[model samples]
Target: MEQRNGRRLILLPLPLQGHMNPMLELANILYFKGFSITIIHTSFNSLNPSTHPHFTYHLISDNLSESEAVEKDLLLLISHLNRKCYEPFRECFASLVSDASKEPVACLISDPVFDFTQSVAESLKIPRIMLRTGSASFTAVISAFPLLQGKGYIPKLDSRLGEPVTEFSPLRVKDLPVINSSDPERFFKLVHNLTYQTKASYGFIFNTFEDLEQHALATLRKEFHIPIFPIGPFHKCVPATTSTSRFLSQDWSCISWLNTQAQKSVIYVSFGSIATLDEAQFLEIAWGLANSKQPFLWVVRPGSISGSDWLEPLPSGFHETLNGRGHIVKWAPQKEVLAHQSVGVFWTHSGWNSTLESICEGVPMICTPFFGDQMLNARYASDVWEVGLHLENGLERGEIERAIRSLMMEKKGDQMRDRLSKIKEKANICLRQGGSSYQSLNDLVDHILSLESLALIKHD
Candidate 1:
């Protein structure tokens, strides 16, 4: 191992909340280990560096500015950012390298989605480490892109949506991320390019523990030549001493409301930052909560429902009917909400971060996955881990009511809670001194120090 020195590391995170959180968490881990951190972010979904004052921040130009009229489609948004980020990033990187007085840039830790960073790092002779924000199972699926493409699964058609992907067992065709695009071929090409980018990097850092996704991580190690580090449920590893939000202000009032409620009574609901539901679905969800007769805390973010900046009025007489039984907010402090004794159930979109946090808190989930790795995460939660239940069928009021009831007041829900407790225990064990995450984190820092030493030797 190289001797400890104050080295600089530049991080490029995909400009989305889900992607940014884990990257920032990783930066926090490295910063504590004596690395000077510089975050190069894009204007679109830009992070407020003031929250992390210890790290230097640079803003690069992006095609999708916060003030500009942006594309509504997720694929189009991603396409624009990927195409626009390269030039600005290159210029900013050059400036960083030219400065000699500051600690030299030792390595570039990039979100796996941003492949262009790999090329820029290589050109600048900086080692690049890829950070995968999703679960190991999802990464395993993504890492097998070549095989999927060869088997004609890349541009999956509507007819084949229900078929099982035999090569990747337990991952049905429906679980595969399907981009809603007019240009399906272009979408497939974009996915293929992004996923393959990780293979070119020096190593990988996954926000997962060893026991949680052992098989998937094992497969990834077998397939890739580089070192793989599983150091996460990151929020637990390093406490969030600083706020890290670009948007979506959190409402803490719900915490008080949760305190007033009975233990194991309130069902906490959130669909994450990006997913938008139509009017019908929104009403169904509202009616379901109301009909379930369970005290609930729901996050109905601005623009959560399609075609409106705010949720269209819920089912008529819904608020009056609930009276003081339900609490609604634009956003809630999710980790705290899950940790509360009153929050017995989590009705979530099954985003990786939310799933992991729920697991850490031992809160069973009612998963209604939206897109991307969520489908796979939901599968792991419900089927593999047996810590959650999948909300089957479309978003109907009756189905939603039934699912909530099943998860909150039934024997199955108790079993899920028990399993979740075990999972939480495992996560705690892995994060302890000399545990899986603890050892992986130490190894990651050692690897980073070695890179710094190599860079210094080359410069000398």
Candidate 2:
């Protein structure tokens, strides 16, 4: 570990699993670069501090009721957090600033969803940088929301779902991000706040590399007019270690099972931490995997299947149909599983982290996006990148089985793997010393250090 520089950088992460993992990974990266780390988090879905012993942890009440704590509507929960966290965060931040013994504070880094942080950082005269946890292409789509809405494209008409979003090539009307709420205005308001506040930050940090998203990055730089760093594949930038950010315990036994399977023969299925399926849809997936007639390792997160506790709703003789061909776990070490030689295909929800991880490992995907930027990511994977197949229709066992065979037991799958191998090589090259990501990381550190001088100028 690099020696601490006695300058602390504070990070506030959104409480969701996908959001928290990247933030914590970035925290670890910066810590290894020699800055002291402090994490300010909400009491709901609180992180275990012992897991990240190197960092200082602070908790602020989110004012969520027991029911609200288990709220399925993500937008409402985020709105509540924005409204309630402002005062507590201000107080907590003030206390941190006034402490005489701690290192001089450098700047505040936070997930862009917490738009409230921009005002708080301004009030305290602290520089704030926003870390975008999604793809640059998705950010481009978000930045164009007003235009898309003005053009009467949003609140997407079911009739137009298959029509092209002319402005966003290859993206159809249904590929736009969505909220699962009765009030559409609420989602728009949140988007407006997120986009407006992020533009006010000192700089934007994305967990993507230039080679993978050159055009999107170019568009973003022109729009935001702030320093943009595309330093990513963050997990690859650092050594693999036990992650402190997981909400579910990983079942390592799956690795041993993968070991027994033939090379590039096991299909790995996981839909990320969120994204639920009804019992009927869940049954379709279970049967689909069985019907694929290939060895598979599936991560069926507890509570992810609606109206069922764990695997209670699994159909009769589901295991016998597989005849020891499938392995089911509540969770598995996803990166390790992806890197395993026996793993050939990833059936995913196209969550950005999972997408990038699959790309890094040269694994082709079968995308069944649930919501938000997932649809857009899935479109890019299947339509643009040609590294995955998109199951645009709702789940059915026959369709699932065919999609599986096309990727796992056919020439189409070989073509996807070939394309992904090239993309994967580009990802690896960008991490080397002279690579775009390597240089961007250095620039990011320099930018953080320069904030101290900017602060000194303000004080003087």
Q: For this target, which candidate reaches the highest TM-score against the unseen true structure? A: 2
Please give the CA lDDT of all the candidate structures: 0.85, 0.90
TM-score of each: 0.95, 0.97
lDDT of 2: 0.90
TM-score of 1: 0.95
Query: Using lDDT as the measure, which candidate wins?
Result: 2
Query: Over the stretch 413-433, how does candidate 1's per-residue lDDT look in tens digits?
Result: 999988888889999999999
* lDDT tens readout by residue for model 2, 1-460: 7788888999999999999999998898889889999999999888999888889999999998888888788888888888888889899988897788999888999998887898788778888889999999999888899999898888799888898999889999999988776667888887787789778888889999998889899999999898999989989876566364878889999999999999999999999998999999999999999988999999999999988878999877889889899999999999999999999999999999999999999899999999989999999999988998999889999999999999998999999999999999999999899999989988988899888777566546
Worst lDDT window (10 residues) for model 2?
Answer: 237-246
| Model 2 lDDT, residue 309, Cα | 73
lDDT of 1: 0.85
In model 1, residue pairs whose N, Cα or C atoms come closer than 3 Å (at least 3 residues apart or on different chains), thus clashing, are none
